[model samples]
Target: MCEIGGGMNFKRREFLRIVIDAIDGKTESIVVAHKDRLCRFAFDLVETLVNRSGCQIIVANQSKNAPQQELVEDMLAIIHCFSCRIYGSRHYAKEKVKAKRKYC
Candidate 1:
């Protein structure tokens, strides 16, 4: 529940419990420091699910950044991530090409 939201590797016990409670009409409100803190990549999905269950979500520290600025930042982050992955595998690709050339 207190784990970082970088990836989906962590065990989300409390989160699942909350969602179940929401579905069963047990929980009324879910407050968090930020919407993404509750779910990094699935906030919209979770919100829709809980909303249908009559549960309300509240973001304490709402983003002050403009929508355009946030979009640009998100795009840049994605590009940077893929760039790192591609460039990081350049050495592996070079090795594979060298091995294929040796076989030829």
Candidate 2:
């Protein structure tokens, strides 16, 4: 299953389905072009769970440069996530202050 979103989001339905299928022994194997393509973090944990359930994760590329690229991607994703949260919180704070002013 291909996911357009960043691998950081574990709440994704496709990702969750794959994990459940692997745990249930329904999925024999999961193949990805790169390690981070499967997940950005906690890959070892997932691999262990899959292996325990008789499933395997096949990573086709193990290049030295892959980790560097994955790191860049992960950093960017983290910044974007935090920036969105900060912006949302600022908007909410403004709205709350406005409501208080109107009430006063």
Candidate 3:
């Protein structure tokens, strides 16, 4: 089986390193637990890898030859990141309100 790492866990540089190392060997594929694990920058990553390494990425949770995987993954990543940002903003707003009430 191909070695796997997550973008959520590893920084983009680390993810790229892992991918490059995997491609340097006789590995036929790089397996990710999910599509987003491969990259939040899915299109660019795929294009670069396909051009440079010629190794395919297999998202273990995805079906073979899924045509929309890249687009779907990118959209999902955007949504997830946006949600986190919004949640953080809301949390900070709530904390600010509580602090103002306690002090003023």
Could you give candidate 2's per-residue lDDT for residues 43-101 as a string of tens digits? 89989999999999999987677878868977897898789889999999999999999
TM values, all candidates? 0.59, 0.68, 0.46
Alpha-carbon lDDT, every model: 0.77, 0.87, 0.65
Highest lDDT model number: 2
lDDT of 2: 0.87
Cα lDDT of model 3 by residue, 8-103, tens digit: 544556565666675675456666776655664544556366447666766678646466975686578678878888999999999999999999
Candidate 3: pairs in clash: none
lDDT of 1 by residue, 24-86 (tens): 899998888877667656678888999998999999999898989878866775677678779
Model 3 lDDT on a 0 to 1 scale: 0.65
Per-residue lDDT of 83 in model 2? 90
